[model samples]
Target: MTQPASTRRLAVITGASSGIGEAFARAYAKQGVDLCLVARRLDRLEALALELAQQHGIEAFAVQADLSKPDATDRIVTALAEQARSCDILINNAGYSLPQTFLATKAQQQTDFVAVLVTSVVSLTHALLPGMVQRGYGRIINVASMVAFSSGAAGHTLYPAAKSFVVKMTQSLAAEVADKGVLVTAICPGQTESDFAKANGTDQLVAKSNLYKQTAEDVVAIAMSANEAGREVVVPGWPNKLAVAFMKILPDSWTAALIRPQAKKFALPDPTA
Candidate 1:
């Protein structure tokens, strides 16, 4: 039994201040879904919220909180309760990569990545899943990366591992919730034109790879379509899909040998250099 779109179609989007997150917010707003936008930058979130509301005539509420914090999920749940809203869609899109190699990066930084990339997502999904299950309609889009399908290169050990977890979890959860009318999908986008490049100090690399890069809007469109169709995982671009497919058939030993020589190309430069 499908419910009316106006009944309980509010969406909760984390990392909604910029980049792919903001793109998802705008996409959902364009579909007339009310939004609860979460991000650390209160000003940006507020401004985006206002803009979306005016431009799309959809309700947009900004919740300012760092997803890296341990209590972030609780805070979000509390805010939603206060508003008498329950989440119909959850876009767990908040994450950032540490620049240094696994050994060189601070232990605390690694822990914080786990908190934001893995724990926060699990917690928020747990908090929101019950209402969605009861209502018998929901959508969850976990923003992973194309790297999720392949082994790490350079200083990106935890990123691929965490994203791999998201992809696997989405698969399992899709199986569990399929009969309940809820869809879970992992959106794996390749190099994208977003603030990610600026934050990681890879703007030059990104600019050089413009021919292979995807726009945030294009990625969001693919993700939304995947979610609607209950796709377990989606790799956005044709090149990325081809690359991942090739990697899948390649032997691990050969893949590792090939990647080792090319690893330095993706390595981050020393901040002090």
Candidate 2:
């Protein structure tokens, strides 16, 4: 049965136009949760919001904002206020990898990447967490990656670093709010079938690989379960779980050596070449 509008929870999902973000939005809508879908693609977000609201009998709206911009989170919060809604759930899922070496990319590009991957997560959570604390109910899920546990590779230089920050931040925040009724979790998924690879220009290479890839739906399901159970961190599939375990058990230097060469394949082409 659909929950009454007054009692239905509102979830704010970043990057909701596609991939894992879309998956989370669909899952929450099925449970009768209203949605604020955030992304740069206004048209896609509007279509998704309309479709989900109609199909699920819930309120859903699109908030177009580029998280790389400093003002984006403020705009999102303002939009929610305009709708008279407070976030009961926040999914910090907006992220991308540059696939270029640190020095090869312009400083502005690196900063923008960090803004989306790190700054936005902290900013959005900071803005909405107080209300959740006051209400004594909230769920926050930070979508990290299996690489969070792995050592840094040559390319996609900041990807692992940012994700590691997310994992640690989730753990710390979850500990702080554990007794206050707010659940925080970091879902570190392995290679999943999504536009993530395509955005990073690795889709074809990934497709040709034999490595296991989880569906975005499965990743989100695991994330939702973990958050509800108050788990601090979770890796979706067993293969991913095993990989994380190995990274933890192995020496850092060993893991770094193993990962660097393989990761170079996905790196952007040399600028001077």
Candidate 3:
């Protein structure tokens, strides 16, 4: 049944089939917000769409596409426009690891990664910002990583660099759109329990439970609150917050040293790197 429309907002979550993105969809639906969930997996997205609509009585639109492609951002905009849907929130959570160093990743693959990590965010914002500005209402959450503070992260260089761009860009956008009631947040959490590592053959990264390992639920909860409260960037846990603080206090070389082995464990074989 279509629930009576209220003042509740609508959100579009990329990578919504599983992991953090899926959690965000569930969380948002709990609030009775309309959803347009996008991901490469059609069956999974449709299942989620049905679940959200049935469980929360909110509209759930599903879009299946590979956001890592160059045309992905345009496709998202076009799809939404076709449905006459203008989302009040955008959660950019579709990212995976390279499993290699910058030099190891093929040029084409690197280019695609760059498109997903940087260009997609930019394009989506460009497409949606005008409406958000006009309405003075919007929330944009760009997901980033814990490695953004390091100099030589050893193996995962390009991924961190890309994430750093997201964090900085989102922070800047938040300041610019503050007065207009458009909120932007960069959710930067480290050592997450997600398939991102497994896809890259770096699943061992999460094996270290002795260290801080945050759940997708926890990370998204922090981000949702930060979005509501207008906090620009949110690193979910106490330990991760401390880690970022320590990185700030330590020398770049020391930070590199601290991150070396883990970086090595996940290093993609980039001979050039």
Give each model's clash number.
Answer: 0, 0, 2
> What are the lDDT scores of the predictions, listed in order?
0.86, 0.93, 0.82
Q: Model 2 over residues 1-273: C-alpha lDDT tens digits?
A: 954345689999999999999999999999999999999999999999999999998999999999999999999999999888899999999889998788888999999999999999999999999999999999999999999998988778899999999999999999899898899999999988779989888787777777788999999999999999999999999988998998999999999888887887777765854
Ordered by lDDT, highest first, the candidates read: 2, 1, 3
Residue-pair clashes, model 3: 2
Model 1 deviation from native, Cα RMSD in Å: 3.7
A best-first ranking of the candidates according to their TM-score comes to 2, 1, 3
Tell me the spans in candidate 1 whose CA falls farther than 4 Å from its real position: 1-8, 270-273
- Cand. 3 Cα-lDDT: 0.82
Please, what are the lDDT tens digits per residue for candidate 3 over residues 1-273? 964444567888888988999989999999888888988998999999998899988888888778777677778788778766787999998888677766766788888888877888888788888899999888899888767766656565578789889989988898899999899999899877777777778666446436778889989999899888989878889989998888879998898788786567656566774
lDDT string, candidate 1, 1-273, tens digits? 953434537999999999999999999999989999998999999999999999988888999888789889988999998777899999999888875677777788899899999999899999999999999999999999877877567676688889999989889999999999899999999888789867767666556543478899999999999899889999999999997886688886776676655655555764544
Top candidate by lDDT? 2
